[model samples]
Target: MSNNKIIDLGSSEDPLVLDCGKSIGPIKTAFTTYGELNETKSNAILVCHALTGDQYVASEHPITKKDGWWSLLIGPEKSIDTNKYFVICPNVIGGCMGSTGPNEINPKTGKEYGLDFPVVTIGDMVKAQKLLIDSFGIEKLFSVIGGSMGGMLVLEWLSKFPSYVFSAIPIATTTNHSAQNIALNELARQAIMADPEWKSGNYNIENTKPVKGLSVARMAAHISYLSEQSLHEKFGRNLQNKNKIEFSFDADFQVESYLRHQGFKFVDRFDANSYLYITRAMDYFDLKAENNGSLIEAFKNTNSHILCASFTSDWLYPTSENKVIIKAFNALGLNVSFVEIETDNGHDSFLLDEPEFFQTIKGFLDATYKKL
Candidate 1:
């Protein structure tokens, strides 16, 4: 294995053939691994990341220097228990991390892929991950775990390569993008495209960034990740710095200030074009359509044990969405478990400090490991 964490696939005859019928070659997958793979490689777990997430799953984020996004739930003695399982999280192809995304140079044009990069689907993302797993010489993953967009990838994995996955945990995600979800994504995309600095996705050439547009997009999307109850508890009508509300458009409320901070900070670490591509991929995701308009048919090939979880307050991907999946599993008589955790943290409850959520995951993985 190379000392550098970034795994270089190098120019090869077997380039990544995408779902769009286009091929991208010499792909590089940047990832991080925790713990060690057992001799049989039966203890390896693949951890898929959500939107705006990188492969730095359990390490300090190189850019922000903050703890890893899932540091709370993954470590030596954490819920997932890194000490027992080898965990690998790779930055998806459309991501801005070290992955080969729109920000990277195209071998043919010698410039960034920009808008020329083919739109990728969740299936494409899982295909890229499958290559990474093959490179590791792992025949079958002990378990695949993820939430939100990550959860979508988990579903894609189970559908595309049923035999390669032993178990799966898809948290707070649906098999297909809902109409409301597509509308929200369109709003965010319009925000980015509206900025003149975007320059038709060639923002890098002019040395100008679509910061304002991207910031607004992030702010808008951030609201959907939190529940009304949690937002109220955190910053309900509270003044930012003054006792009285300012008449100007300046941020007067604490909530406004908080959102502005999140928006601006996000721009510093994320790419506008990459954001567009990833969200477009999500909007195009419809497993039912891919499987002859039958959502249950998509999982017909998978015998992998599955644990589907959702939060009561997660309106974006509510318990109802998970129930839909559980019903499908029941129809197939597959070994599946469903849990609706009571939380006020909304769709992001999986990422928050919910003891019950952690316990549920720990318990499931532990039981699954014993069987393995």
Candidate 2:
């Protein structure tokens, strides 16, 4: 039996409207829950997954048979202790793991949506998540937490439906995608599109996939998620299974081999079209532009306690980016905390076994729960 739960949301009467001026209905969302909802139903927490993450937050991933992505920080006695709080994690609408996306059959034509899938925005994603939360009758979430792209969703939740969130932690994320960020995403998209097998996103119909293009895209994107220090420490200039470079386009260095492994491994689980769509969404994310050119105005509706954390070596979304968020909260005089965790693990530090990060979240959540 699959470990996750699947729910069909939206209907003919109430279709999910996309930012692109399109509508879809009866969208399927795969999710998983941990712990139990208390009698008051106030201890519920929403955990948004990152771009490549699914609903397997604290359980085994059915595909890879690997431990949940955020297992390090969630469990019976972990930071977001399930014993004390109920956790709800749902696959985003544009996800491939049993969610409505390009890989799924379109009800209108009964074939894969492919390029025909409606473009989704961060706001659209948060809107879909709200439906799932409402399904559980959760009036206000005890906390909504995530890192990286997941963090962007948290910000969207705070901005669009402030009253529904009690507290939030947006880690290793920015208010908007920087120019460099957009450039990197474009590079990945081009890589996928350049593959001959892509066939304008109709590879599925041909019983083929642009695995080479997708793998290269994943490799390039994965590098941005790490710091130079971490890379040097982990692989450096070491040769890959050889005493010296006998290489002529082969993976001569360990770093190249490592990245190749990561890239190829990722292709086995992720969908190429999904990657294209999600990256485009990230590139289009801009809180300032969305809220009349004012980041503070974007969050003015929120009264929730917020904590923003960043890694010192995370050039992808540096501490400065995170501070912009804190500055907005500060301008609004909202209860907020900022932590620049000292780590060289880069943007992926939040996903690693960083004790300081763990303790910080644990303390903040404990304090927030007490206030509840």
Q: What is the TM-score of each candidate against the true structure?
A: 0.98, 0.99
- In candidate 2, how many clashes are counted? 0
For candidate 2, the lDDT comes to 0.93
Off by over 4 Å in 2: none
Which 10 consecutive residues of model 2 have the lowest summed lDDT?
A: 1-10
Model 2, range 1-372, lDDT digits (tens) per residue?
A: 346999988996799999999999988889999999999999999999988888999999887988999999999999999999999999988899988888999999999999999999888888899999999999999999999999999999999999999999999998899999999999999999999999999999988889999999999989999999999999889999999998499999999999999999998999999999888888889999988999989999999999999999999999999999999999999999989999989998988999999999999999999999
Candidate 1 has its poorest 10 consecutive residues by lDDT at 1-10
Scored by lDDT, the top model is 2
The TM-score between candidate 1 and the true structure equals 0.98
lDDT per residue for candidate 1 within 1-372, as digits (tens), equals: 221177766365778888899888878788999989989999999999988888988888877878888989998999988899999999999888878889998888899899999888888889889989999999999999999999999999988899999999999998888898988888989999999999999999889999999999999899999999999999999999899987999999999999999999999889999899899888888888988988789989989999999999998888887788788888889899988898888998888889888998899999998887
